[model samples]
Target chain A: MFSKILVANRGEIAVRIMRACRELGVATVAVYSEADRGALHVQVADEAVFIGPAPALESYLNMERLVEAAHHTGAEAIHPGYGFLAENPEFVRLCEEAGLVFIGPDSKAMALVGDKIRARQVVEEVGVPIIPGMKKSFPNLEDYRQAAQEIGYPVMIKASAGGGGKGMRIVYQEEDLLPALEAGQREAKAAFGDEAVYLEKYLEEPRHVEFQVLADHEGNIVHLFERECSIQRRHQKIVEETPSLALDDDLRFRMGEAAKKVMQAVGYTNAGTVEFLLDKDKNFYFLEVNARLQVEHPVTELTTGIDLVHQQIRIAAGQRLSFSQEEINQRGHALECRIYAEDPAKNFLPSSGRIIYLREPVGPGIRHDGGVYAGFEVPIYYDPILAKLITWGETRDQACARMKKALEDYVILGIKTTIPFLREVVQHPAFLEGKISTHFIPRYFSEWRPRPPSPEGQRLALIGAALREMKQGRERKRPTQLMSAGQDFLSPWQTLGPWRLGRRS
Target chain B: MNFEFMVDQKRIPVAIEKTSQGWEIDLGEAKVVVDAHWISENCVSLILEGKSYTLHVVPVDNGYLCYVQGELWSLGRPTQDLEYSQADQAGAVGDKLKVKAPMPGKVIKINVQEGEAVRENQTLAVVEAMKMENEIKAAQAGRVKKILVSVGELVDADRPLIELEEE
Candidate 1:
């Protein structure tokens, strides 16, 4: 194990990896941008270093600064958690050159899989089922239109170097292809610094299922079963679960085996996910490879009782597979809902502000992996995800019921979130029955919204507001507990950590 | 004490009194005597009409936001009417149309100048927030009266980016 590890990321994933490093008695060094001063991740780490300005391109995305920060902190390993530098093969190469262990696959493997078009060609050679599409990116819109003509209508446009739905669009007509392709290329360039993109046949109503795998340097790889991630909005998954209600035992085993084959073909290492889209007739096609620890790994952790972060760090440290495949048993069903700092009522626009209140759900089956505090500012320069809520139970019904209740119990103020939207999802009859697909949000919730607050609800809210005002008025007359709600400074309570957020005891 | 608050921009009245049994609150349509207890800082537990509920209140800009269950409503005092605070709220405010950035972000593109005609739903500008670009559109056919912000400048959640005089 490394004596020290530098987390080249920010927000919840950075905090999450730091927690794992703490558990392993490894010191964690956090690198932050100007926007992330006093962020929860900064406070939670053993040491902190300033990277650059708020723009991620100058800060988190700068490979040189991240490597320098790791060197300054004497970190032997760098854990690129999920977003910024996780899948960037160049960053991996830089870390290797700096003699710092990059806690993921080698640059060669990352480059091979990072290019989705190339991965498809290679996955096909291994005889794994894949969606039929263009073999390479086209030079112009006219070329793209011709390719789409061959693929038929309702084709999908995807960034060649994309994940997390940034550079992805579905066009059902030739008229929409040009604009959609241009937009995809632009987003891909902004997100991945790559303008290349390819086309694919849009699979209708396919359930998005992905398998988790762990491979070691000693060449041992094992599949950790599947996670059903069909619930999505804007092509990004919002809800996910393990032991998909869509798959039976026989089908699960085959998909799991196929997922291992896909990773094995690419020489994938550490922790990565193989996504597959299962059609209405139960036939599955390769979606893409998520070449990092995913945002929804907690769902798999609760069911399989394996700490994936621990495995990532250990694997990068040249540790062999600590356990065999037969020993890994998924005991129960698990579900995860991504909590984002966005308002669902207003097209899910990002809500950036200081969080004035936060109350995480807690119980025997609920888990919250959070990044924001009561007074922390959610910066506008990065992904809007604030946390993820996961729940586990003996049965799917038990898990679903717990998830709904936990959502109701979860409270966050000062910014809009998707708690209400996710609550509506788990309560839907189709969701409870597991009849979901990648188009679930559009098909079911195109115009779905929370019912207007009843008269009783309105009254209570107004009265509550009045009471708060009255309290404020009294405080103005006689200040107590340092009563000043007008400032955005860090209160003593925020510096006093482990109190506001419901950290796992 | 009588308090008038704007709930989602619609003003409503709330009156509270100290009664023999805890506090009595009047909400125009109904009157009830209730038990209110402080469960935590800014969090209240109330028992009214034989029903129990928990409400969380936090101070926001020129107002407070109260949350219960899945509902969150903002309460702003009518004393200082800063219309800019309503920037991210759906729909144009007070009939004077303004194209505002939905969230705080760096402005990437401005499609029109101070004196330019635009169609309803025209993409007036694009602001990148949280790494995703959001296009600000005109509510109706209008002429841009003022370009309040420039491209590549950072903006807040409700700051007006462009002022429009509608047809």
Candidate 2:
């Protein structure tokens, strides 16, 4: 076991990985940008390093600086926690060249599976059904149109470089193709710095289900079932759960086998996920493979009783399979809600400010992996996710109910958040029935406006207002004047006093 | 004292009074005891029915700075009657207007310039906030008055950015 490891990421994920390292009796070194000097993860880690300025390009995404920090600190391995340099193949290669283990899959596997088009082609060769679309990048508008025609209308144009819904668009007609393509390319270039894109058949109301696969360096692999990640906004998943309600025993087995086959095809090692799209008719198709730890890995961990991060570390340390596929048993259902500092009312635009106050939900089956604290400023230079709220229960419904209650108990002030919107989504009819898709938010909530407060609430507001006025009035009056006014029965508190009636009762 | 309050959009009546223990509140539907302590000139900590709530009350120019559970909620006071005087001046020519930023953000791009004609929904500027770019659009058809913010300038929300004259 390594004595110490460096976490080359920030926010809740860094805190999450540090916790795992602690339990495994390992010390952690955290790297942070200037904006994150006082962040929770930075404060909790055993040691901290100042990476760079606030912008990720000069900080978290700077691979050379991160490696240099690891070397200077004498760290044995570097854990790229999910985002940033997590799946960067070149970073893995650099880490290897430095004689430090990269706590994820090898560079070759990441390169083969990180590319969406190539991943799809490999999965199809393994006999896993894939979405009907082009295997090669379209050269021009005419090629794109021809591909879309063959795939039928309502085709999806997606960036071949990265995921997380960036640079992905659905075109309903030929007229919308050019603009959508241009916007997709522009967003892709800005987000991934790669303009390559491919076309695919867009499945309407398709549930997003993904299988979690864990493999040892020795080529032993197993799948940890599926997670339903259909609840999304703008193509980004907001909520996720394990044991998808949409999958039956047979379908689950089939999908799991297919995912295993895809992993095997790439000679995949360490923890990775194979994502798929499940249509209403129960047909499943390969979406892509995330060749690193995922944002929603907690759900799978809660269900399968597996510490995925621990497994990743062990595999990177040259450990073999700890458990066989048949030995792995899944327990109850688990759900995770991503709390972001974004205004759902304003189309989920990112909001940033100092966190004046925070109250995290606590109780049985509730887990909060958060990165911010009261007085910490939420910077505008990175992703807006504040925390991941996860809950586990004996059943799916119980887990959902617990998650809803937990969300209500959770509160953060001084910034807009998606908490209110997520509350509505968890209680939504379609969400309760596990019937959701990428279009869930836009389809159900696009025209739905939040109703105003009720009359009883108004009365409370009036009381609140009167209280304010009285407080102000007392402030304006001198002590002698306030004493003189207190002697009068016409005083605001004396005139319509409920205390007087209560004494009579 | 009896008070009318609006919750959501409905109006409700409430009554409250001091007691030996603390204070009592009646909502016609139920009665509850509350212990209130003044934390600051504009803030109070209240415990009602076993639940704790902190309220911050600041006197804004027009209304109240009502902070509840750490959130700054706005409470508008009912308007008072005042005498109104109508202006008789008309046919005044409009000159170049200066536009200010509505919100504080770093300007990512400028789409238009001074004396440029813009239609409604036309993108005039892009402001990057929390790592996402928000395109500021023209509210109505008008000719450019004046652009005040340049790319990379940080601006506050609701600050005017451009002045426009009717085309």
Candidate 3:
């Protein structure tokens, strides 16, 4: 076991990794940007280091700064918690060359699976079903149009260099193809700096299900079932769960086997996820593989009694697989709702401000992985995900009910959040029945306006506001009045029961 | 005594009468009981139907300082009457349309200049918040009359960012 490890990330995931490291008797070193000087993750780590400025390009993505921080702190290994620099193959190479263990798949494996185009080809070669599309690159409109005609209408133009719904477009007809391709290429160039794109046949209303796989240095790979990530908005996942309602015993087995095959082909190690798109007919096609830990890994952790991060660290330390395929079994249903600093009413745009008040839900089978406190200011530099509210129950319905209760119990002030939206989603009939897809939010609830507060309710609110104001006025007039009232242990309003002026009462 | 309370520019008249059991307050169409307990020299606790609400009072410039749910709100001397009335206006009568920001974020890029003609759904600006860039577009075909915000300026939800004149 390693004595110390460096966490090259921030936010809830960083805090999550730190807790796991402490439980495993390992010390953690946290790296932070200028904006995160007072961040929760920084305060929780055993050691902290200043990396760079607020912009990710200047700080979190600065591989040299991270490597130096690890070397300076004498960290034996570096754990890229998911996101910034987590899947960067170059960073893994740098860590390897510096003699510091990268706590994930090696640079070679990352390079193999990190490229979407290459990964698709490799997986298809291994008999994994892929979406019918072109594997070769489309350099111009002629090549794009030719491929589009062959792939049929409603083709998907996706960035070959990155994932996360960025640089992806869906064209429903020929007239929209060229413009979509152009826009997708532009976004891909701006986001990933590589304008490479590929074509894929669009499957209407497909559910996104991914398998969690872990391997060791000895080529042992085992999958921990699947997570259904169908509820999304603008290509970002909002809710996720394990043992998809779409997957039965036979289908689950087949998807699990396919995941293992992909992992074996890529010579994968540590913690990674193989994503698949499941159509209505239960036909699953291979999506790209994530080369690092995922944001929703906690759902799998709750269902399976395995510490994925601890396992990743151990695997990076050249340990052999501890559990066999037969030993791995999902005990119960688990679901996670990503609580973001966004307003669902406003197209889910990011919301940022100082948290003036926060009340997190707590009880049985409820887990909140958060990084912000009452006084923390959520900066606008990074992702707006404040925390992930996950709940586990004996069954799927029970888990959904628990998630709904947990969301209601959660409260945050000083900025608008998607709490109201998440509350509605968990209570949605389609979501409850596990009948969802990528278009769930935009298709059904896109125009679902928040119902206005009724006039009677508003009148009640006004009365309450007025009463509060009057009490405040009296207290201000005589500060000693409050002091004396405090001594009496009676409310000032109660003492002065009925004082009257006039009118309509 | 009957005192009328105005909140968020709306007047709410409440009637309070002393009773042997407690205080009976007529709040519009409902009658309820009020239980107040002094929490400190600056705060009081109000309990209603098993739920407790704490109120913090302090002195402000022209009125009293109030804190509800940890948020500081001000209550000044009653001046203007609180009323909600519909405004009668005409459509497309050479009036400048206010373009309020859809959400709180820092303006990243401004793609249009003042006096430039823009079509509906045309990109006007990009607001970068929460690590994603949201492109703000023109709601209707119009000419840009004024740009109220600049790049890198942090804005709140519904804050005016631009003004558009009918084409």
Candidate 4:
């Protein structure tokens, strides 16, 4: 095993990778931008290196700086924890050139799968089902229109190198196709520096499910069950759960086999995820392959008792697979709610401020992978995700109930968050019954408002607030000017009962 | 002590008087006892009708922002008549529109120059925050009078980005 590994990312996932390395008795190095001098990931690592300025283009996404940081720290391997350069095939090649092992699949497999169009072709060649769409990117408007017509209307224009909903659009008619194609190309060039995009047949009311696949360097591969991630807003997943209600035992087995076959076909190694879109009739089609550890990997980890990061490290060190597919069983159910620093009421606009108060939930079957402390200032230059609240139980209902209770116990103040909105989602009857699609947020909660407090609760809050001011004012006053009994309405001697003041307040 | 409490934009006038037993709060016909004890700097324990409630309070400019039972209330001693002003709530009025940022972020691009005519929904500036670029658009057709911020400047939420003169 490598004595030291460098984490080339920031936020919760960086900290997560370092934690796994530390447990394996390996020292870890953290690379940070100027804006992340006091970031949690830097504080947790054994060594830290300043990469560049605040912008991701100059820091996290700069492959030269990342390799230099690893070389400077003498890190034997580099773990690009999701986002940034995690799935960049060029970054993997650079790591290889610098004599450092990239803790993911080789660059050959990544190049084959990173391009969405090429991925569709490869999966289809291996007898895996893919959505009926263009085999390659369109060159011009006429070509795109022809492909859209062949695939029928209501097709999707997606960037070949895009994720997280950027550089993508859904066109419902020919009139919308030109504007969407132009917009898609512009966004793709801005986001990925590539103007290549392809068409995909849009499936209405399809549930987003994905299978986790882990492969070792010695041609051994296994597949974990599936996670239902249909709860989304603006094409980004907000909530995820394992052992989807839409998949029965038979369907789950088939998806698992299909995932393993795809990975095996690509000579894939380390941990990766194969996403699928499950339609209303229980038929599933391959969506794309995420060639790195996912943000929602914890949901799969908790269910199968598999430490994916540790496995990734082992595979990079040329280790054989420790467990077979039959041994990996999905036990119990796990749900994950991504707690972001955004206001759901304001079109999910991201908000940034210092965290004044934070109370993480704690109990059996509960885990909170948080990245910020009470006094940490959430920066405006990165993702808005602050933490992930995960819960587990013997049954899906039990897990849902635990997740709802855990959300109530979680508290974060001084900035807007999606906690209240997430609580509403988990408690909704449709969600509990597993009748959800990617349009869950828009169809059911487009104009949802927070549940108002009871009238009695409001009255009590005002009274308490008024008294709080009075108490603070009196404490700041001079001792000699302290009010006597019956002098003012805010006199402590009059407001405090004798019996209650004796005990702890 | 007399104060006005703002809850969801509705202001309620409350009056309190010291009594032999506890503080009596008068809100029109309803009277309640509020026995408050200071627990810490930002926390207070209050008892009303034998039920205890713990409240978190943060002192703001001229008022107290308190949280109780997952509800937020702002209590302030009305400086004067406490009339609600829509000007503070909305950014602009009449023909002119004040383009403001939806959230705190750094300005990355200024698309329009001062004195340039812009149509409704035309991109005026791009502010990048939370790793996403949001374009600030013109709400109404007008000529830009002043650009309040430059590129790479950090701005707070609702801070004016550009001021438009009625065209």
Best candidate per TM-score, number?
Answer: 1
In model 1, the runs with Cα more than 4 Å from the true position are: A473-479, A482-505, B8-13, B28-31, B81-98, B111-119, B141-149, B158-167
Report the lDDT tens digits of candidate 1 across residue range B30-57.
7888888866657899988788999988
Name the regions of candidate 2 deviating beyond 4 angstroms: A138-150, A458-505, B1-18, B24-105
On lDDT, the candidate that comes out on top is: 1
User: Would you give me the overall lDDT of model 1?
Assistant: 0.87
DockQ of all candidates, in order?
Answer: 0.57, 0.22, 0.27, 0.43
What is the C-alpha lDDT profile of model 3 across B1-167, one tens digit per residue?
57664444455567776577555678778888867665555456677666776655543334344545423344444443222111213333433367777777778778899999999888888776665767888888999999999997988877778889987
Candidate number that wins on DockQ, 2 or 3: 3
Docking class of 3: acceptable
Q: How would the candidate models be sorted by DockQ, starting from the highest?
A: 1, 4, 3, 2
> What class would a CAPRI assessor give candidate 4's docking?
acceptable
TM-score of chain A of 1: 0.95
lDDT of 3 by residue, A151-228 (tens): 998889887766766678888888888767866776565445567888889889899999999988887889999999
Interface RMSD of 2: 8.3
lDDT of 3: 0.79
Per-residue lDDT over A1-505 for candidate 4, one digit per residue giving the tens place of the 0 to 100 score: 9999999999889888888997787888999998898777887887899999987778888899999999999999999988778888999999999999999999999887788888888899989899999999967778999999999989998878757666688999999898679767766665565778889999999999999999998888899889999999877789999989998889999999999998888778899999999999988999999999998999999999999999999999999988998898999999999999998777778889876655577898998887776567888878898989999999989999999988877767677899989999999999999889998989999989877677776777677766765666678785664442112222232133122223343
- B107 in model 3: Cα distance from truth in Å? 4.4
Which regions of candidate 3 deviate over 4 angstroms? A136-142, A174-195, A454-505, B1-9, B14-25, B35-100, B104-109, B113-115, B145-163
- When candidate 2 is compared with the true two-chain complex, its DockQ is 0.22
True contacts kept of each: 0.72, 0.21, 0.30, 0.55
Question: Which residue pairs collide, candidate 4?
Answer: none
lDDT-superior candidate, 1 or 4: 1
- The ten-residue window of minimal lDDT in model 2 chain A covers A485-494
Which CAPRI quality tier does the interface of model 1 achieve? medium
